[model samples]
Target: MRIYLYLIAGITSALIGWNIGQFFLTDLGLFSSFPELILYPCIAISLAIGMVLNEIFISSPTRPKLCLKKAKFPVLIALGLGLIIGLFSGAIAQILFLPFFGIPAVIVRIVGWLLIGVAVGLAEGLTWRWETVEAGDKKRFLHRLIASIGGAMGASFLAAILFEVVRVFLQEMPKNLRLAEDPIGFSVLGLFLGLTFSLTSSPSYLVALRAGSGFEYVSQIFAQISPESINLSKDYPRIDQSVLTFVSDSSLDRIEEGLSIKLPSKGSFKIGSNNDCHIYIPSLPDHVATIEIKSREAILIPHVLYFNHIAINGEDLKTKKNIVLKHNYLVTFYSILKGENNSENTIIINHEKIFRFVYYNRFFDPQG
Candidate 1:
């Protein structure tokens, strides 16, 4: 299978979905008349792209050849995946946008359901579902997960580049806090964005890969690679059973020293405590975690590129660690995983609000 061809197909699918979605938005007068209204269609289209591309990969053996006969399956798969992607993404989007926009929640729910078709379609196109893998695959889940991480990192970097280019062209920066004008609303928005991204991108693919055939390899590797990412989230901490120990800034004074049991709120969760965000964020599994964060002031800092993980070029984890303490650094739990590249279980921290972190050229200070 030609990787580049797959990429091309993915891009083409996105464009097609976007155009179709754009029409829907235009007709509803959503962009201007009710900006929130368009979110579902726009995102559904994006998912449609993913679903279609994934479908193409599926059913095509030995380097996908140009055959229209086989193309229909992906479209069908896309329709199915799009239904899911659209509803879930749209629901998340609505939760986030409604409070800020003051639109009714029911409306957003309806919107989400409406776009499920597109979402299902996009998932088919974009996801790395194994059914789509070409013949003669050699790599196990571990390798595929690694490849996914690499791909996701690349895609994220490209997105950063594109966003920057667009920002420069428009003479403006992305919005961070106005969305915060309604914290509850913004939180919902973040959830939607996270769901959208998870469904439509590398996170989904990576999770699938890790969960598939090589689940053992994926699980073992994560177990061997931690202690650094222990408490990235207040509510959700990274868990690797193979490794008993955990890292945290806050002492585990509140819980019984040896007591480990089920969590009441979410069925079950391991208890560990920490104040430091750096170790937690990077330490957590790379494939499936949620990051609850927002930009501080929305300023584009120079020399700061957010890749698979955020890093200052030439600086080591040590420096990034220091940067975390001095400035809260908008920390949150993120599930980083090896990418067999087709799991849709990622949780994203979106539109994070970090008001205290200040930047000084190549350096950062937690104090705003």
Candidate 2:
């Protein structure tokens, strides 16, 4: 069902983009001479639109951050292979059919459409295959190549049918209309090519794969934490503010006043007099404090701050403090003489984990 929906969305977006391109070309009076050229941009635009809509409406909850950085090499290779196959096939088709049909102009046009469709399909298919399928030996490469070629052929056939339909429609248009000329034919042809391109675009496949894999990872993490059972919505933290402050030894002068800080779900930050700390608090012992913020809560591990008369929420921190930070929290450091340090401490909250939990829970465990 999801696959069908994705296909429908892609086709619809391609048709819309095709009409838009045609309108532009007709309005600008550039449709007659360079009708085939419009297909390039139309196809690109349609594919982008389809992908974005699918990501936003169809598969947003499970979507993951695509590792585009790692996929660049495979994408480039796919593009190159697709171009080569398209050019070679197009050249052969033109050579074989031009003389047999004895219509140079028509043969050239058809060959161009075939080239665009096949090339776009193969490129997109290969890229998607690489991302969805695991990387393996040369056998996997052969399988991917075959699948990509088959997709390209299917796209080319569909494009051919669409081109004939549009061509027939244009032929039936009123003779007095300006669009009844070659512009109409070419515009329809461009639309056909665009549809073909959208049918095999890689964006939807990659997005869906990434999203599904991300959900699996999240589930694994949750399972590891608690095998019996866990309530993600209840356990996750919903932070409203995230701020951190640094206090110096001097009561009158603060080395650094206050700065907003952001923490990831699973990371640690250190603050001390040494340069190794994320925030340096001068006049305090080296590595005086450490903060570990997880998806559930934040832990403050005080080293020398325990004895330095550091106070959290008016309570002296004689030991480590496990703060259940909500909307707001404050931490202040004081000297032995009960004088407040110049550094300021503030808390910043993040609700990404909580939101993720709620979204998943709503869809996956509604009864729970």
Q: Which candidate is the best by lDDT?
A: 2
In candidate 2, position 204 carries an lDDT of 17
Q: Supply the TM-score for candidate 1.
A: 0.31
The residue-by-residue lDDT of candidate 1 on 285-353, one tens digit each, is 333212211222112121122222332232322221223222212222223333455466753322221
lDDT value for model 2: 0.43
Stretches > 4 Å off in candidate 1: 1-7, 28-73, 98-165, 172-368
TM-score of each: 0.31, 0.36
Instruction: Please give, for residues 145-238, the per-residue lDDT of candidate 2 as tens digits.
Output: 5554565456555655666666677677776663544434434433443444334332211100001101222365877788677434322211
Report the Cα lDDT for candidate 1.
Answer: 0.34
Best TM-score among the predictions, by candidate number: 2
Name the weakest run of 10 consecutive residues (lDDT summed) in model 2: 205-214
lDDT of 2 at 113: 53
Ten-residue stretch with the least lDDT total in model 1: 206-215
Off by over 4 Å in 2: 16-20, 23-32, 44-61, 64-106, 173-368
